[model samples]
Target: MALLDLDPRAVATARRLAERAAAPVIDLARRHTTVSLERATLRLAGITGADHTHRAGDVPWVNRVVDTVRAHCGLDHGAALPVFHALAEHGLGTLTDLAEATAAGQVQYRVPTGADAARAEGSARAAIARGLRAVDRNRADRDRLVADLGDPPRRPWLYLIVATGDIDEDVVQAANAARAGADVIAVIRSTGQSLLDYVPEGATHHGFAGTYATEENFRIMRAAMDEVSREVGRYIRVTNYASGLCMSEIAVLAGLRRLDMMLNDSMYGILFRDINPVRTFVDQRFSRQIHARAGIIINTGEDNYLTTDDAVDAAHTVTVSQLLNERFAHEAGLGDHLLGLGHAFEIDPALPDSFRLELAHALLARELFPDAPLKWMPPTKHMTGDVFNGYLLNGFFNLAGALTGQSILLVGMMTEAVATPFLSDRDLALRNVRHVLDAAGGLAEDFRPAPGGLIVKRAHQVLGEAVDLLARIADDGLLNAIAEGTFGLMKRPADQGRGADGVIAKAEGYRNPATDLLDTGGDQ
Candidate 1:
């Protein structure tokens, strides 16, 4: 139920403008393939482990295979055909064998110029089918387990983060949080891991702020969470960053591990990580396709905008980004249920009508994307070190969530911005959310904003401003607007950024088995 009567025409206009703005970028994405995409292909082909040639750090086998393919055949034909052809021609028994040969500098991938494309594609499809089957098994297991057990009995599922920089410690904290009433446990990725071009192999024990997002780490966490789920008589969901340079690769891993949700956003890497806009666009498309095929809910990063830009002045930008994210998600075949569109409660508490404004914003998003599982972020931008005030602010944040019917609420800790939250801190934060949820859980069902009141007025004003911003973005191409710092007040030119070199325009016969698999509804 919409507390504020938002204008349908204005919403449609904003959507139209966003669609127009995303058109060219989407076209670019369709026409290009990135290194991450190729590497994801190798991973899907069953290449595990890493090159141990270096004493310090091991390079992933996917990297070695794709790097070899790039040097020999170029990525125009993609990594699938070349690797498949090499495997068939040399009679390599498995992908790992091929990787070993490639690492030994004894293999040269043949460019599929006049080769039997059908045979190569069939072989590639078979390999990818194996991986796709694994993903389907994970999904099936999750559904069956949830059916056998149950889900959290709440509207806004409590989301808590674990960032102990160690996988084992994260598991302990995650279990504790689950027992403490956190419905979802997000294992935050290590800082700067987003910038890495390749995912680290195997379970890691050391990190600066958070654990490395490796396939092994995901596997370990999944096991731990499964045990916790059984212990609690409810399924425990896990999440990690499927953003940054290896967006699609991480998506592949998440699918393999049956991660419940992923931090997948179109503009986040461009705005925050300085990743090339075109590169991020291409990667996000493939990543979302994987998420769609894996039945994974994708949580966008619209909340990050509030951290960098003024929450009041930049309110419309959040809506604008949400509209675009919704469109992109749809284009990638994600249903509304899988689109965990994000927003936040980051408005300054000093404002006189802050609660009303927060209500308006949250309600606006809830009304706009009624079916979407909106991931409402907690206050972080204005989180002072004062524990008492921070606790009060988190209470207000939780109140907004309960009042506006947020789907996924990331519990705000009083220690936010001051330190990595201790387990005790998370317990207190969860208690705050529990208090608000228990007290006002049913408020959204019964409450309605006063007609022409502050909330209604603010909602209309934000919608109007969003329409204006969308129009401006449509007039200037999305890429140009991004280069002009339209989103997070950070300009990332279309040409320059990390991973620019990875973007390759598709050749005539470019093939990605994953896309074809997704299109065929391969074992979802």
Candidate 2:
């Protein structure tokens, strides 16, 4: 009678997660924060480094157009998407000012819609006819540089990080990472940048551990990777966290700037950062909507749960989190391609058949979201300074990723627990991954779950347990459930944690014209 084999209890848990998300969704909508057209335009200018003084808000379409322009460009969060939408839509040669874009032009300055699929398609065809050459050109510029980027490919993706403290240093290291066979480059934000409600202006020179996640930083890194990606003859992804207070804003910025991936979790903040569960969920929904629109893949944070709990006993929790994340993303209009569901190889190696158990758990994720770019996480649980063991563990982690068919494999580093990786360390890690993958990359394909095997039985049993937990979460609120210690060995309350002030009700007078216009525009 059931639509799927998952127990009715799992359905119940999913329902509870949705219920917990409901109050926050409605509350955020009701708050209704408003920004003036002039101010929004000004903020937009700063994000893209446009030093123009144009005040065209007096025009009839000024206010309405500003709303659309600002939202598309991330004016609200003080980060501007690098797109000169006004110019692109109009085919104008310059963005000397935003006002010029809204002016009449030969190009269709107006956007197309669901009812006008043919019209949009026609317009797209025309643009491709003309601009296709340019896209190919710019893309070629990136591709040509790819060959110089050390054509090494790790079967599983390389796990990487960024330092907001210094851009030059970050760039040098990022380039080196690519040469060393890193498949992903994640620019860690300046310390506490996410906590700040407003984004900083201009190219930053100084940051703490990583460079500031500014528009310039994004552009700089994107351009850098294009060269590497082309050199390697494969796609190299750029990643940044789109969480915290400015989640929606960052997603918009990331999309417009051509960023490929983001760490955009549903309830990571409330569960870990203490962001109000209502605000986090609501913000996440809106942020993901933009990501879905921009064709950006999102990396969820379910793997963080195991860092605190017993990996063996709490394996089911990871599955539950993935299910919840998938449902939430689907509700937000994300497709399988946009899902980079997260899981880690963090179980202590000392446990019995830890490696085999990991394989079972991982393969289950691969099966669940077969079409998604599953992001297999690196080992963070026991990343002690013991570099030799850490490196071996990472090798094993890489083997799991390659075996299970994870699309976004994040390779672990031996120095994860000690410090940022040294250049030499990265080289060695790459070498390690290459050896295993070359020697045994196809190991998983040949191995099947043993008949009624311990690993298989435990995985199936854990999945059922996970479904039960999801059912409970559905009945209770996800926040209320989390407050009750539903995940991560730690218990955090919805209303009791920090960053509550950062959780603000939208001030009145905020108008999002794009939201209104796209309200009926099906997400796909």
Candidate 3:
């Protein structure tokens, strides 16, 4: 299925280097925990609702429980060990009860004895197992729906974005897009939501540019998608961003609500959002474990690199990131099929032979990760106010996507830079993608670059550069490379960034049963 003749040795070398670069980071992730991660563990223990009576604000019960544990006993032994101990020793019935009593100043945490520790650990494992069973039920429901209703019968499933700053409004728009031939509907998160340290509660109506990614909103939108799926005869998949400070929290929520995909990448958070590398690494491992158990695909953010750096000049960086993403995701138990590795068509249109260069890059990614469901993004950095030119650029993008056999194609709106896309703009963009895909869908079957042709040569050159870059990164260490402004032109030190204070080193006797359960897809 490959178009270009690539060197297997070089590809192996790149993979080896990527794994070498990721080994140290993976070790760090294994030996550390985060506040959000512990909070997510509490959430999996069946804690819900918020403490509106608190003087500070409407704090989630998970937050209150974790905060109490952190302030009182510290988080070295993991939040679950102490919180569950408090419950068992005090004869509390549920984590919710413990959280309530903690908020009311009724529960006092303490280290437990032999019998008390055994009882607490056993009860905590049972509760976490129950929560994981809920996720198992959700996954079963999704599988049943897809089996009975079926999914889109095409490559490059049309992906559309809906961001109305309101959950109800987003539901209506998402259903309409489904009816209009969108295979996947991604509800864009509200602006700046990623930077918030905690996940919000309930369905929000007032956001700046996009809807909040709360569990309530996820439930509401997924319900609507199911209804529309029955009407359209194709199962509609829902997506949301699972990056930033509350990455693990959102991943757990997505599992409970049965989201189909999540925008998740630790490097994306560290480089673009200024999140601490250590914190991002720890959170992403726990988040991806949740995703792996929930049967959700993860879309990395390598495409965003092109938005900040020149696509032509930084092409090799995209490849290097993809390799590293593959290694990190694999280390976290994500198979190739679950990795929606990202790339984009953002080269300036005025550049000579830009379209050919775009094809070369796209083909290279497709060949590199053949089993991955590549999420091919369209041009945004080069989009101007000229709608016609933008539409034409999208046409070429669609053609490239179809030619390269992209698995998920995010539809590009012609009015991208001019304004937020109206429904009419989405319809027009869908029409453009449909025309190209229908007309030239099988072009790749007959498309063959000449021996040593420009396209083939460019691909080889980029692959060589990527291998070289991966070697340097492996030698320098991924964290040090990031601090040196290696990816996306951002310099984020491992020790200094947002949420660095949230990272906590694990105690010598630290243990988390959730990870043990999820390590084998929750069979335990």
In candidate 1, position 298 carries an lDDT of 91
Q: Write the per-residue lDDT of candidate 1 for residues 1-524, one digit (tens) a residue.
A: 66688888988888898899899889999999999988887787788899888676798888989999999989987889889888888888999999999988989887665656668888899989899888888888888998998989877889999998899999999999999898889999999999999999998999888899999999999999999999998999999999999998999999988899999999999999999999999999999988987889999999999999999999999999999999999999899999899999999999989998999999999998999999999999898899999999999999889888889999899988697545788888999999889998578788889999999999999999999988888888999999999898999999999999999999888887877887678644
Q: Which lDDT values do the candidates have, in the order given? A: 0.90, 0.63, 0.90
TM-score of 2: 0.74
Error in Å for residue 251 of model 3: 0.6
**What value does the lDDT take at residue 37 in candidate 3?**
94
By summed lDDT, the worst window of 10 consecutive residues in model 1 runs over 110-119
TM-score of each: 0.98, 0.74, 0.98
* Model 1 ranges off by over 4 Å: 522-524
**Model 1's TM-score against the true structure:** 0.98
Off by over 4 Å in 2: 1-155, 496-511, 522-524
- True-structure RMSD, every candidate: 1.2, 8.7, 1.1
Give one digit per residue, the lDDT tens place, for model 2 in 346-374: 88998878998888888777765668888
How many backbone collisions does model 2 have? 24
